[model samples]
Target: MPNYIETDYKTDPAFFRSYIKPDLWEDSNALYKEYMSWENNKFFVQVIKQFDKPLLRQIKNIWNYMGIRPKEWRCNFFRVLPGGNLPLHKDTMSKISVVIPLTNMTGELYFEDGTEVLYHNMTIINTQVPHGVKPPTEERIVFHMGIHDTYFEEVKIGHNS
Candidate 1:
């Protein structure tokens, strides 16, 4: 389980650092209350399909790390329990996936990365490479997104490679 993380990625290092400190669950209810006000006064529960455009733009950064274009993008949140861990799994050895912990994050998500565990934020994860998460502290949460490279070439970030 500790032998399948892909280390060579191309995302802004700053993004990971910015996510170092987070705490959203405390205001989750309030956040939900005004969520509609966030994306045009529209109330969307159970998977907000199309979040604010800026978020979509941020997600584009994932393309650089994946080194591929995407066909589509989607996101979801997890109501994780204290010390709950997802089992090792693959989303297919070649597709690209992006996962970020919400502001309510408490623990860390570790990947095999073929050698040592690498914790990432706002970056691409090689789902086929095999990965999972480290049990987080109580009340921790996360957002996992899937992107299909092929239709995401135009989504660019200031990544020079």
Candidate 2:
């Protein structure tokens, strides 16, 4: 399968703004790194606590667009500082993961095959493979969601074990 696939949702500035805490976007705080977590690297934000009705509605739409009807899911708000890069790793936390960028930054998402995505929109990344991100000039913020993947079941039981 492909490493990533761009979703049908176009970038929505208003929707993005509605979910981001006003304090985190302040110029003075933009450079700071802040995130919530489920596991060591499974960073996430509780939607019910950090979002309103409208944002929740939009998130539901996003879940539908991705064809994910999960009984449970978690959201991550990543506030990446300037020149901050995540190490190469596989997302073992979930079978499927999606990344939706909220800010435009100059950076690259690199895969093991040497393919790099320079621009950001709504992209679904196959977390089973090795992948990583390069730091950008400006702070990068992205919303990441983890969902169940049946395909991962067999792989995890056989190859990963």
Candidate 3:
């Protein structure tokens, strides 16, 4: 299978202003404990548990646009500081993953073959392969949604994990 497939789904600035803020990430310890296996403690992620009506509507619209009908899904709001970086890993609980950039900062997603990918608003990544993020020169915020993977297993860590 292909490592990743690009999608035409773009991000809505209005939705970013409405749902993706620092406050939404403040109270997500329970959700994080359940889903993510964050190996590097340097990165900060806020799991969005209680989505607002408008945000939910917008997410629904995105799902429709992607032509995906998922029974359940989860969103993680990530904040990577200038010097922080996440190690290479694959999604264990998510079948499909979509990352939406919420900030204008420069960052890069590097694949196993050492190829670097960058985008502004939205991008779709194949969580089944080994992928990692490089620290941007400035603060970076992104919206990550685990669309369809349901079987949560052990947390993987590092480039060889």
TM-score (all chains, Cα) for each model: 0.50, 0.70, 0.76
Candidate 2 residues lying further than 4 Å off, grouped into runs, are: 22-51, 149-161
- Model 1 gets an lDDT of 0.46
> Which prediction has the highest TM-score against the true structure?
3
Ranking by lDDT: 3, 2, 1
Could you tell me the TM-score of candidate 3? 0.76
User: What TM-score should be assigned to candidate 2?
Assistant: 0.70
Could you give candidate 3's per-residue lDDT for residues 23-116 as a string of tens digits?
A: 5445333434433365444467777778788778878777666656577778877887787676676766777677787777577888788877
* True lDDT of residue 76, candidate 2: 58
lDDT by residue for model 1 (1-161), tens: 22223343444434433433333223233434332233212111134355566555666555554455565656655455665555454654235555554445555555555333434444445555556555556654445566654322332343522
The pairs that clash in candidate 2 are none
Candidate 2: residue 154 Cα off by (Å): 13
